[model samples]
Target: MPDRNSAAHRAMAAAVARMPDPVSYQETALLETDLVAAFGTCRAVAVSSGTAAITTALAACGIGEGHEVLLPAVTVVMTVAAVAACGARPVFVDSAADGRGMDLNDLAAKTGPATRAVVAVHLAGRTDGIHDLAAYTRATGLRLIEDACQAQGTTSGGRQAGTIGDMGCFSLKDGKLLACGEGGYLLTDNTDLAARAAAYRTHWQSDAPDAPAGTHLGVNFRLAEPLAALARHHLTRFPEALAQRREQAAALHRAVDGTPGLEPITAAAGEEPNGYAALWRLTLPDPRAFAARLAQAGVPNSTGTHRLTAAHLHPACSRFASGDLPHARVTVDALLAVPFTEHDTDEAIHRRALTIRREAVRWTR
Candidate 1:
């Protein structure tokens, strides 16, 4: 938390200082253009927040009453809530037994006649497991919605995570890469899908004077101009910043590798990560004590968010899931993310990390 404000952020602040009022800002258009240029489509539309991004995308896709939305059971409630808000059911798929994204087996099993869409969440910034999910969506004839909100720089093979799905939603939340306090975007290569989502965020406007009633039902999910400007500036620096995040994560891997009682997610060559630390989640017997110990050691770290149990944990669990699934439990066994503040390299921060892990290593030993 201490280093959340970093040199990269200060650089951005300086640039923002010279900017005009956010309401009339031009960065919104520029960032959208940059996003389109990088992703190869104008289907990219910015919105107010990640939840709004997911909900707007859901609304645009025509998912509502009587639909069953399949998503990771271990995800934040927002994914399920978005579906429920549309008067649909939220079915859950646990992470693969290997522990990455949603399990294909559950996805296959839960998808039925009422299943209209699947929200494929890319946990952390890694997307190695999404290819098969994409294939599943294709085979089932279900619409694929990639939740790459936590996966800004993630990809499968050479293709970026969002591009492979029928439509993808990304959040530029405070903890995300290229964050703009709270902002989001929906991406796709499909033109009709693009038009539908664009109209879903605003008060309904189309070039055609005879635009459908679809435009009239939108909420105020629009991104503010100031946020868009910062997002635009940050987008320009993302390619370079991404390289640094990879560097930071690698350093942590080296500093803490093979430490007793710790299980790090192994990175494969084909599955390059987005170079961030919303990962490094370890499994320990007593998570609370371990987290406390790490804090006492002066290592900057904390738990990753968006974890949930079966809706049984809440009265509404029955509404979205039959029971709590395995990964939700697997996720609780001491998941912690190393600090990835942009200003400092992992080299500058690794000693404290090693010291913390070495201390915690005893519990595993």
Candidate 2:
């Protein structure tokens, strides 16, 4: 639980005082402006949810029927649902063996005539092969959309995660970095696309009351005011929070460094990742048993709990999956998320890490 006397709480209280008008108010506009400044994007649009942000990104980029969008096989079902909502077919790409990125080889092999775009998800705020994917998308002229919902402040190659793609979507759900309880936003550098997304956020209502009808068909996905206030306050604390998480992550990494069957997951070279969660890969033969042992030892851990399930395995997305997903299947099975939070003390993190190492060694032995 968050402290009631914290800075974020004070900001929230101020927001509540200024509320009753969420849409056309100071907080909303201020949040939008602050986001654009923070992410170095040309524009920002607050929306109802992360899913809405993705859907808006798809629609704003002109992804529609008969088009194909390539996404990682191991992703949340929401990403697939966003594609389906746009009436575009999703082509499930395999994950890389290390679980930090999409398998570039599989991504290249899956490209075809109808492939209009690629949605690159930054799993747990850890970066992937952005430079390679950016080059690939440019050479092929395919639009790139980043699903950085779990990666609010992640960056790579001197650029932010959401800004690297043609459009980027973020989530502000309960457990997200910038928790607004339930809200999301989009980032983009393209002016025209930004206009489209802004229009879509408000049901395509004309900017000018005197103008003819709406310029494009749209949906009601506007982010309310109170949540924006909470997000804004959390945004202010992001720098400090991110730094703390990095320290915690480093501690966890050191804890498992000499462990026989546990290792910290990593991003690509030169990519500075924003710590979202502490994740590890198990080399032991029975990861399920390891997870159980950790739980029994009072250190709850899980494989495929946070986000390891493959989207292709879900019925909603099965229609789009084809061929073998060897890497995706393997990565999902091996990775485990160790519970971590920004508020956790150094003592707590070290204890949890020790539990992980001790249980892992016992299990493997």
Candidate 3:
């Protein structure tokens, strides 16, 4: 959580005071401009939430009923929900050998005639296999959308995470790096897609002469003024916040280096992680026991955090399940995630690391 007296709060207050009307796009447009400049994208569309961003992007791409979208098995349920909202069926792709990213082979095996797009998730802020996934999608003529909600400050091969795909979506929810309570945006270089997204987010209200009113089906997904102002303020502090997170993550890594049964999950070559959380592969026989110990020690952690099961297994999406995704299931069981937020102090991180080391020693014994 941000301080109540912080610049972000001040920005929100200012936006609220200056609003002349109820449905204003002043601050929202400014936030979109900042996002475009920051991410080097040609255009940006601010929406109500991350889910809205994905749904709008999908609609902009002309995907709908009878379309099948490929998404990693290891992802939040919201990703699948977004596809469902667009009347598309989600095809779950298995995780890679390390359980960090999508398995390209599985993605290839799953791509069929109904497949129209792919949503590549940069899980835990790591952009490890996105480039390869992008290449594969291009070869198959499939549209690629990057779920970069956890990778605000991340990069891969010198390019921003969201800009690498046809379209990218980011979250600004409470726990996210650029939080504004609840907001999200989409980034893309395509002029047509950007124009469509802009129109789709606001009831398909377009200024184009040739486009009719409600040219395409759309709903109200606009970002509120105050939230957009707060998000803009947070964007200014992002560089410093990201640096702090990296430092803390490095400290945690050093502390857990020699601890038995704990192995740090690192980024692949040429990829940069945004340090959303310090992740590890728990080699211990009982990962749940280790996680419980960490929680008892005041260092709250997660095994998979809403990714414990494949998205297809969720009751809302059970009808889409085609087969078992063993790797995603195994990976979730063996993984451990420790979040390091902007609010955490160095001492707090050190204490958490010590607790992890202590617990690892006890559990391995």
lDDT of 3: 0.83
Q: Write the per-residue lDDT of candidate 1 for residues 1-365, one digit (tens) a residue.
A: 22438987666545544443232236666777789887766468788887777887787788888998888766656666777887778887777666666777777877799999988776567675677878887888888888888778776688886888888889988867778888998888877777666666764443113345332466667798889988887888888878887887877777776776566776555777786663555657776467666766666554322223433344565654576686655664456656575767555676766676677767676
Which portions of model 3 show Cα errors greater than 4 Å? Answer: 1-24, 207-211, 304-307
Ordered by TM-score, highest first, the candidates read: 3, 2, 1
In TM-score terms, candidate 3 sits at 0.89
TM-score-wise, the better of 1 and 2 is 2
Question: lDDT of all the models against the reference?
Answer: 0.70, 0.79, 0.83
Quote the positional error of residue 145 for candidate 1 in Å.
Answer: 0.7
Between candidates 1 and 3, the lDDT winner: 3
Name the best candidate (by TM-score). 3
Better of 2 and 3 by lDDT: 3
Weakest ten-residue segment in model 1 by summed lDDT: 206-215
